[model samples]
Every structure is written in structure tokens, then in C-alpha cells.
Target: MAARSALAILAALSLAIGGCASQEQPATQPSPGGSATSGTTIKEGLKIAFLPKQVNNPYFDTSDNKGGKPAVEEFKGAYSQTGPSEASPSAQVSYINTLSQQGTDVIVVSANDKDAICGALTEARQAGAKVVTYDSDTNPTCRDLFINQASAEGIAASQIKLISDAVGPDGGEIAILSATANATNQNAWIEMMKTELGKPEYAKLKLVTTVYGDDDDQKSFQEAQGLLASYPNLKGIISPTTVGVAAAARYLSGSEYKGKVQLTGLGTPNQMRAYVKDDTVKSFALWNPADLGYLAAYAGAALASGLITGKEGETFTAGKLGEYTVGKDGTVLLGDPFVFDKGNIDTFDF
Candidate 1:
């Protein structure tokens, strides 16, 4: 029953976003004194900069407009989202430097390369800008907060479960289609999935191969095709990246193995809907990105307003968002992974 529902949702998402897969970047300006109206008495006109891994991906674009910008406006601060045209850590470092030099009060970022961007984040902190990581995280010591959408273990385990289920109780050959070889989150999740696959319950599941898509739609699509050609008995594909998932689904949907091979991974509802409808993918998981952005803003505002410092084990209330506790490592898990399927996919527009 669960598998059937997930298949339906994936189809819906593919139909919704596949035709308009071209990335769009939207700019958000401060609402007219909406920040002041929130009535949090703090120094007025604070400036916060949000740096995503890339500027054009719909995932981060939604975060900027729906999550970060409104939170800034509610706090009577200025917010801007900027990053490179592509996911380049070096470019992100340059933007961090520029924001720091401009005397920004806070800077939140989704890192492109985890270690490569640490120095820049540390430098921003030294320049009196509170550094926070959202989406993809940096080194814990380098940033004050990490706004986690979900725990690393939880996300990876869920993907493994989805694939294990799709391949049946008696698992067979499977492969992973991942984004960039060096992606921190992807690597972490892949590792966890590997561990999960080793469990006795999944003894028959064999992760035979791994491929990189570099988060490029074309590259991912080609990689999926190559995997299919290389492994005739490939039972499932766990694409941990959003781009990889969509690309794999599209490839499978058009192939003779449409329902024979299962594709499961993290993807936006709008991007994987069609594949689900065609029964190319069984299930996938992701947190609400907009809520992630919203929570990130809430955390940033709480810190800026002196409501809560970025200390481990600290707790604070985000207006209308309820309470959150800072974990021992300065990371905050927003919530559980949202598993989307037919039953509830239509209920969520984003």
C-alpha cells in the first residue's frame, strides 16, 4: 500500500516540474516595515545574507524567497540571497568575503565544498558576522549553527529502506547515482546507506556500483542510462541527489525497464511526479525545504535579537514556530524526513 502511494506522488511531481525544469532565481525584497511590525525590539535594519550552493536551483531558490527573506523582513532586517551561477565552493567563498567586508551582521550558507568553505566562514566569523550553515553543512567548529533538515542517519536509512522494499524481501543488484563525488551530504548519506544495507535484514541487497552526476541534469541522465546498460539485472537505484533522482526516473520511464527497475532518492515533488505516475519510481524522501528556510531564519533572528545565543544545549522560541534546542554540536534538526506518496502529495503544492 505504501509503495503504491509513493509511486503516485512521484508521477505527480514529474508531471509538475519536468516540463519547466529550467531553474529560476527569484529576488525578494523586504516587506514594508513587516520586520518592525513583528515587534521584536532589537537594533533596526539588520543585514543578513543567505548564500546557497548555487543561485538557480529551485530547491535553494524556494528557501531564499519563502524561508529566509520573510524571516529577515519580520525581524526588521535586510536579506539578500546570492551565490555562484553553479555550485562552486570557491565562488561561495568569494561571496562570503564580500558579505563580510560589507559589514553584514549574519551570513547563512549552504556549502558547495564542506572543507573548502570553512576558512571563508571562519573569516566571516572573525569579521563579527555570525556564521550559520543550512542545507549542506560545513565544519561544526567553523559555524555557530547548522540548520539541519533531517539527521544524516535518518535520511540515508530511509533511502535504503525504500530501495530494499522495492527490490523485494530478497534483494538483488543495486547502484547509487550521487551528486558530485565530494559533496559532504551525499557522501555522508551514502556511507550511512552502505551501513544500513549491511544489516541482516538486507543481506541480499548488493550495492554493485556508484556513479556521479555532478548535479547536472544531462550528466545524471546519461549516467543512469550507462548504469542500465552496464548492469542488466540492476534491481534498484538509490539516487541521493535531487537532480540524480529526477534524471534516473526520466531515463527509466522511457526505457523498457520502466517498472522493472525502481528509482528512489531525494527529489522535489514537482520534479518527480510524472515518473511516479508511470511507475518508474516507487518512493523517495525529503524534508520541507521552505520550512527549513523558515526555521533557519527563525534561528538567525533569534540569535540576532539576543533571544538565544548559538551555544550548544541552548533553547529558544521562534515566533509561531515553537521551541528549538541547540544540540551539542551546534546543529538543529528541524524534523523527520517527509516521505511523499500518492495519498498526500496533492495536498502539498510546494
Candidate 2:
């Protein structure tokens, strides 16, 4: 993992060096929302701000500080992070307005609501800031690019598979404890999870219900408790949010359901390691959040640099993560989710 981080930093630095010497050329692809510049060199001192769903959240801290901060440093850009402490539909609107007013060149965000922040984001773009949404996204028209951790189908399938494996041949009731109801990414994944459950292979598994945790630890803990109490026959749980998963693990670890009930979802290794070791969780999945933010920073820089416009087939390099293409809907996929269990959970720190 340390080597991976070192390589990522080195790659960003290499991009910076290459940008300085690259010759200018006309953009081959046309942009939808704006025109692409011929400049190949990434501009230094560009003010890049990360507006996550919440401030001081552990997941965002790792993504913004460890991932985004280093990428900005590599590109010689000023970096900052600001947002609400709680994840809510309109919590990020004020921060977006502030960043726009402050003349930020790039605004990387994980939106809480798809449309709630679109107006503020559009205003920022009109003010000349490049909007790049990651982790979660806003309506496509608002952002220049979206850095998706993985495909919604892939993430949903992985979680369903994990829970199915844990529940065994005679699958019973299962429930999802997700983030806020309005979270775009979470809602997308949940819908796909429902689709996956419809398949014949998973016919034995029945989805009991889903509850919202709002990405709050205490609320998620209580929600997990509620789910168990309300559905005493529940056999498994899937929490696709880091906060919800960790909180659910904590609740299950101290209760009678520790080994009897299966738990799996998107979680950082640091938060799920104990649960895995204690037999409270079988396995969970997530892409490296740090890499997700690193890629977002690079994508934002690319937009700001005019290296590539946010158009289908547009390509740009993302440090150690290598080259990426802008797929449909102005989105770049980071990769697939990785499952962590007791066997290899110890190898990761974040």
C-alpha cells in the first residue's frame, strides 16, 4: 500500500513535469458546456477546492487530504476542503457559493443531492470554475466531469454477492442500511441491488427493507439496531456507506447477532478490520477512496488545463492510476470494488 501511494505521487509529479514541456495542440473533441483551449500545460497556482458531502468525515478526510492534497501539491496548485459537517440535500450549497465567490478554479465534490446543489454548481461554472463530482454525482448538466468509483451495477452486485455468500444456500431475509435517501450514488446502487435480487440465482434471498442512516455514526448504529429489532428473522445486512457499515459492525459486534447475522458492504479496512477478525463481518467491498480523490484532482486539473474537454472519448492521465477516458455522461470510472476479509484486511491501512 505504501508503495502504491508512492507510485501515485510519483505519477502526478511526472504529469506535472510533462505538462511543462508539452507542446500546445488543438482539442480534437468538442465540448458540450464550453469550448476547449489549446493549452497543454496545466496552469500552476490554480485554486482547487474539495467540497465533500460532509466535513471532518473519516472517509472524506482520507480522500481529500491523502489523495487530493498530494495531487494538488504535485501539480503546484493551491488546495482546500470545505463543506457542511452533516450530509444533507442542501448542506453544500453555501460552500459551493463561497468557493465560486472566492474564485476557485476547480470544485471537486461528492454531492448529497443530485439537483439540490446543481443551481449553485452551475453558478460556480458560470464564474469559471470547473466542476468535478466524485463519490456521488449531481445532475449531469451541472458538472464538467464525474469520477465514479465503480459502475453502479458492479457495486450493487458485489454487495449482493457478499451477503448471499454469507447467508448460505437457504438465504433468508436481508436489509440494506444505506446513507441518506437523497444520496445519488447510494440510491443508484440500491436500485441496482434490487435488480440483482430479482435474478433466479438469488431467488432464495428476500430483501426485507432498507433504512437511512444519513451517514451519521450514531444514527446508523441506531438504525442497524432498529432493523434487527423490527425484523428478528433477518439473516444479513448490507451497508453501502462507510459510516453505516462501520456503525452496523459496531452494533453487531456487541450484540447476540455477531456471528449469526451476516454483514457486508462498502467499508474502509481500518474500520472493518476488527469486525472481520471478530467474526462480526464476513467481507465487504470498496475502491480506494484516496485513489478516487486523486483521480478527481487530476480530472479537475485536466479540465482546468484544457488537456481534454469533458466529452465522450476524451482521454487524460490520472497520475499512477494511469490514463482514463471520459465515458458516457461525462464520467470516468476509477475501477472495480475490492473485497476485504480477515485473510487480507491486515494488509491495508485505509
> How does each model score on lDDT?
0.76, 0.86
Q: Considering every candidate listed, which one attains the maximal lDDT?
A: 2
**Each candidate's TM vs. the true structure?**
0.86, 0.90
After the best TM-score superposition of candidate 1, give how far the Cα of residue 82 lies from its true spot, in angstroms: 0.5
RMSD of each: 7.2, 5.5
Across residues 128-222, which tens digit of lDDT does each residue of candidate 1 receive? 88887898888788888889878889898899899988889878999999988877788888899999988999999999999999888899999
Clashes of 1: 14
Worst 10 residues of 2 by lDDT: 20-29
Model 1 residue runs over 4 Å out of place are 1-43
Cα-based RMSD of candidate 1: 7.2
User: Among these predicted structures, which one has the highest TM-score?
Assistant: 2
Q: Write one digit per residue (lDDT tens) for candidate 2, span 1-350.
A: 11234345434334433342132232222333345666655678989999999988888998898788877877788999999999988889999999999999999999999999999999999999999999999999999999998899989999999999999999999999999999999999999999999999999999989999999999999999999999999999999999999999999999999899999999988888999998999899988788788889888988988877798877776665666788899989887777788887776766
